[model samples]
Target: MPNPLAAVAAVMIAVSVAARALIAHRGYLAYDDFPILSMADRNDPTPDYLFRLFNNHFMPGGHLLSWLALRFGGFGYGPFLALLVAGQAAVSVAFYRLLRLMLPATWTLLVPLTVFLFTPLTLEAGTWWAVGVNVLPMQLAMVLAVGAQVKYVRTRRPLHLVTLGLSILLGLLFFEKAILAVALVFLVTACLYGDGLWSTIRRWWPSWLVLTGVSLAFLGLYSALATSSVRRPSSVAEVLTFIGQAISHTLLPGLIGGPWAWFPAGDGAPIASPPPAARWTAIVITAAFVAYTIWRRRTTASRAWLLLVFYLALVLGLLGATRMGSVYSAVAGSVPRYIADVAVVAALAIGVALCGIQEREEKAAKIRMSPILLTGLAALLLSSAFTGIRYGDEWAKKAGRDYLANARADLATLPAGTVFMDQPVPEGVVGPLSAPYNRQSEFFAPLPEGPVFVTQGRDIRVFDQAGHVVKGWIDGPANRPGPRQGCGYRITGGPVRIPLTASTAEYWHVIRIAYLSDRDASATVRLGDGEPRGFDVHRGLNAMFVVVYGGGAEVVLESGDPAAGICTDEVAVGDLVPAPAN
Candidate 1:
């Protein structure tokens, strides 16, 4: 007969993987996927090429995987999604292995393992391809490193130490936050084996010293070579504030569902704070747990108490080091990708506590289960799983459908070499579901002459040279209003000429200018220094459409009108295609 416990664990793992696979059909996100795919299209996956591409980036492993996805997966996201699910499954297995080492491998251990597998905090990490690629690999490496540490502690084997070191290195290669794995290994060692704090340090000085040295060396290289644009905590106040906020965000969301579970968006529904009652209750419960843990520490250094402390410390140190990057703000600390590791640690800490309680009860020759404890644990597990699945469906179904519709609409109309601005997608769209191509104007590269496209919600509009939406082309509501409704360049009274260089002269056929003026005015617009044409502008907002026949056009705003000069809001020149008449 099969061990029922083992069967349950296997079933849970299978379910988790199956759930992830079902949601993996969602299309590519714009965040890092677009840039990675673009890179893959341009460069070959050679050692030298990868080195050059990732020399300034800390995540070479992520980049390599993305390159492979593009090379082998073709344009479809199915292959990349498969890889993500596979990585997550491996992390789950590694987690189970670590838990087995820490607690008795009995049916009870399956509870925490199941909860960890379905933790709502993993939803973002598991769904988004780019996030999953970066996070899942690092998580797997961190778990393996912890497992290696456990093996080394038990067997005192040199091979285990070597494995520990290698795993740490692999984690670091995947993400800078992997350094926390080293700290966790040391903390676990001290808690499990050391006679006292100082004694543990004295014994493990050499190991920690080596790890610290490696960390410093890596930091030095990263500082010199890394070109990431993320801002670092600039002052002591910022660092402290970030640490405090990160801790709160991690603990609160992992313990109870909150606004952080929702995917952020430009026009999404507002996120409501947890009710005051619920908030205070969670705080009281957490305080009680901490107080009890501390009280227990005064009597005996039980493994559970020590493990809980170590886990908290690990969470603090990890968030402090990584969350300080500009990529993460204090408010954004609860982001699932950032806190997935914390969820794992919290699960382990809970498992260890349960194990300690059982051990104590056995020693006393009386086994008693607290209904309150069991009820609370069950509630937390059920709530987290419910929230995770609910949001996972939103991301997979609603967001996925919106993204496909937008991609198809834009791709069908927009031609190559078109320079346009991006409109933020609808709120509640979890992944990037806006425009198909890159939308960040700040980093857009020069393109050859082609048709330009502008977006307002899901609607793509063609603009004329005077910066006006082309009439008769789009027959719908004149405009779609949202938070980012009017996003474009604001040009004051000056010679604002949309530059059409030699490279972009032929591909573009028309220039669209969307503008507004305080008073009535007219400006001379020239295309590629060709014959100058005069255009009249009305008060308030106006659109000017001009055909681009040659190189590039220069718009000379005449300053004759003393009144507020024309404010050019948006300008785009590209291949303008008229929509089929309705």
Candidate 2:
């Protein structure tokens, strides 16, 4: 009754476009997207400059698309991610169009496009286009490649086979997850479509060999090389729940109650464990599908079951590998979302269940059922699109305009490799400041590269690679010594915990100086209060520290150190700690 395939594609793209435009209208929806704008504003904006994503840390292809979108979208994270989501809709269209025979038109169309509308997963994928946001592209590539393979098997056409190989190869360019795109395709072919492989290969030898080779190449490159710190699940239950959460989170839209992404149940949430509910669902689903397949013999349901197993297997393997999976779970650069790629394939594998047994009576029934299904699917997709845009689910990029004007002006003043002891992720500033600063001052600390900033005053200090401080404040900024002795405050070997407090209405400063040793640590320092101190602390084992705590204290850790002025990287002014007693 309904052309489900066309309807799904139309709805997916239309919604994605609408979302993109909405975000574009709103400006950079979130501040994190500012980094790309920062880079694009730089004079040397190249792959090298933007290597923070690929080389330094693995973010998504959102950065690539965002920079490119500058020509169209112009200065917004929302629009950039929106275009990516929209682009995937193209792949969604191609997905059902390519699956002409693997399923009835209704089943083929509904299974693939439903994922796009599955609000939770889509919303998770929608955030932060610059880093780990290309889940959509990776899925599209993986799915499109698989679809090409399906077309090859169904139609024995050389073009289909060639296209399949090319698609898989190209998909690799979009994501590291895409490296497995070829392996997944062949794995599916080998396990579920075992009978068809040989015949299909014989018919399309050249294309098959090329794609197969490409798949192998992808596997070789996709190996997890980075050192992983993610520990494996202590119990199988946690694993199941984790996997189940991904599945349930994606499929059962009603189960997810709100706009929030993850639910925190336990304090500190410590369980050297997996998500039991998720894993159990995955295992049970796989076992049931496999058992049903064995009982019924090779129908599409069995195939779907097998595919579900493969998806779970891949997810488990990554977690078992416990290296990449851990990084994926923690950093979320794009791997966990790959689980949905399997969901799509599994839906295809169980193409029969979706159609309710192709019978003469069912054919009449399908006609009636198809309309209701189509209407519901349309309603869901349209709603999802509306929610995505109107409710601000995801964003896209603006036409690449220069966002570097402020960064350039700011960076030029500071010395290269100068570590700014700012707070919060160095994405952007937030909130209002009421002058003289304290521990509450907010600034950007962790940057992509250059000089790393390690602050102990506010936030965690993971930026410090070494264990505990061997010498407490000595390793602070190199120039922080003059003002401490000038003020006559110091740290001795004994437990000297001086509760230094300061509060003022105007902006001032606080400097703590720790030298390696007080030996030869001579300081001829004139305090802003016109007090001067000349002294020499020891050299090797000894250390020295100077702290300027007041309202609007703007003296350098070292005078004439060129890198110390206009320290606007963070404005630490608040109700200040009053000037020290006379």
Candidate 3:
């Protein structure tokens, strides 16, 4: 009465969905994903809002998801990522259905689970909302497109024709970075029956036309709003390199086991780049599989096998061809993902191979019937979850929580609309993520505009009105860390004045100073001709010298007992404090 296989698939998929959704839901959005907010603020009031939106190089699905988030998120990030992860999980199930149709009863549940479990990176695509939105819809389109084609051939129904058309349309939405498998599907169909135009047209014509229509529509859409720069393939040798990378990235330690030695450091570090050996290995394996299948081609089942192989090969060859290397270069890195869909078809061949065997000893029979298969399934899920968690950790590091807590107190002090410039002030945030403040905003919407100074990364004049230097800093005083005595620092070309409209006690922007002192260096603060004051560097990033007496001075980071991570660099004085409490 109860199907063990169906139950496993249901449970595993549900668990996978919940795990990935949590990761996507937890963090603040950054970089490319955050750009959607800037675009939303575009003030572009025209029908072309959607049209112009897709023009950016990032694929489409992400854009659509973020826009939807803006409508309801009030521009927040959590719900947006949550929605994307959920969508991706649903689409993943769609691919699961496609697997069900292709695999036999025994392999049906195991194969799909094995594939996801083995591929760790899939979690990143599934969990990171930006990546999830792009990957899931495209994978769903691929599954549907293939499914529709399969149904059309079996049923010869016009409804299938319409379905295929829509699937193709969905597939065309973005370069999708995954649809390169279409060509493989085509070639697999070709190799099944010796190819010819009329025969080809009859058997695969609908798919061909549908795919073409999809291509044209997507290209038109890309042309309309795209300013994406094309990446050049560095060299022909890169072909071999990319394939190798794909192989390593795709099946390592799962399909074929390997020691943990090869794994990268910390989950956040970049993955292994494409390697050359893996590429050729893939080719050899594919050729061997096809050759064996064709040699054994006999029953109607064998003919179907040939179709899948030929279709997959044609797609690979088309994608793999290097003449216009640039066009296919990024694909080399993407090959692992491409192989995932192909592996589903390949799993069918493997199942057939196992089923075809005649006789075996009891022990041997168990290997075939259970342990090898069961162990493989368990291993796959564990690997996938591990990989997913690694990616989650990586996303968090890139998102920057530790640094934000330290910076936020200072940033919060400055009212919105205040501009405090310093080295590495991340494009929109007060400090640069690479340099200091996490760069999070899309278009830098300056809250308070004034002179910006300090230069560990970039110059300040870019955001200032007068093109003169204004240095600003935010840090706690001395070793003590908290709200009080928070040393706010800044330096500008001229004297700072409290606007009649602004409170005299509440300075819109203050000053940041670093001095060359050990015990305590007291300095002077003079607004126009106010008075000289002194302050000490709290820990670091706050070391700058301000010259209040000499035209309005500079702050030099005083070196004494070496701080944990301070490089010997000069600090500017008169750095504006958001609110100079003193």
Number of the top TM-score candidate: 1
Q: 1-582 in candidate 3: lDDT tens per residue?
A: 998877777776777677767665545555444444556554343445544443244355455555567666644566766676566666657656655654345543455455543354454455544445555666666677666765666677888878877775565453344445465445434533325557866776767777677667666766667664444456667756665445455534323321111333221222432245643454565456445544543332365566555645544454455322664465454433344444434443444333321111122222134575567566556655655565555555542233334344445454444433433333432223222122323233221322233322211222222222233344322211212233322222232222111112212223333322323322334333334434433443434333233222222222233332222222223333333334
Q: Which order, best to worst by lDDT?
A: 1, 3, 2
Residue 379, model 3: lDDT of 57
Q: Is candidate 2 or candidate 3 better by lDDT?
A: 3
* Model 1 CA deviation exceeding 4 Å by range: 23-30, 48-57, 204-206, 213-217, 227-250, 256-263, 266-273, 287-330, 357-377, 397-582
Q: TM-score ranking from best to worst?
A: 1, 3, 2
Score candidate 1 by TM-score against the native.
Answer: 0.67
What ranges in model 3 sit over 4 Å off? 1-3, 22-28, 43-47, 53-61, 74-77, 107-109, 174-188, 191-198, 227-229, 249-269, 273-368, 399-411, 415-582
Clashes of each: 19, 73, 80
C-alpha lDDT of candidate 3 relative to the true structure: 0.45
Instruction: Give the C-alpha lDDT of model 1.
Output: 0.57
lDDT by residue for model 1 (1-582), tens = 897767777788888877766655543453445555656556676655554433234676776787788777555677788787888789888888788776666555765686678766676677776677667877887788778866765676778777877888887776777777777777666765567788977765656666777788778866776665445566677677655544454455455543234544322211223344554565676667656544544322356456656766666555555456554354545455666676666667656555443323345222123576557657765776666555544554444234434444454565454444332332333223334333322112111222344432112354322223333232211111112335333344555554432233433244556676777766655555555555666678767655534444333334335555565535555544444546
Estimated TM-score per prediction?
A: 0.67, 0.55, 0.60
Residue 147, candidate 1: Cα error in Å is 1.3
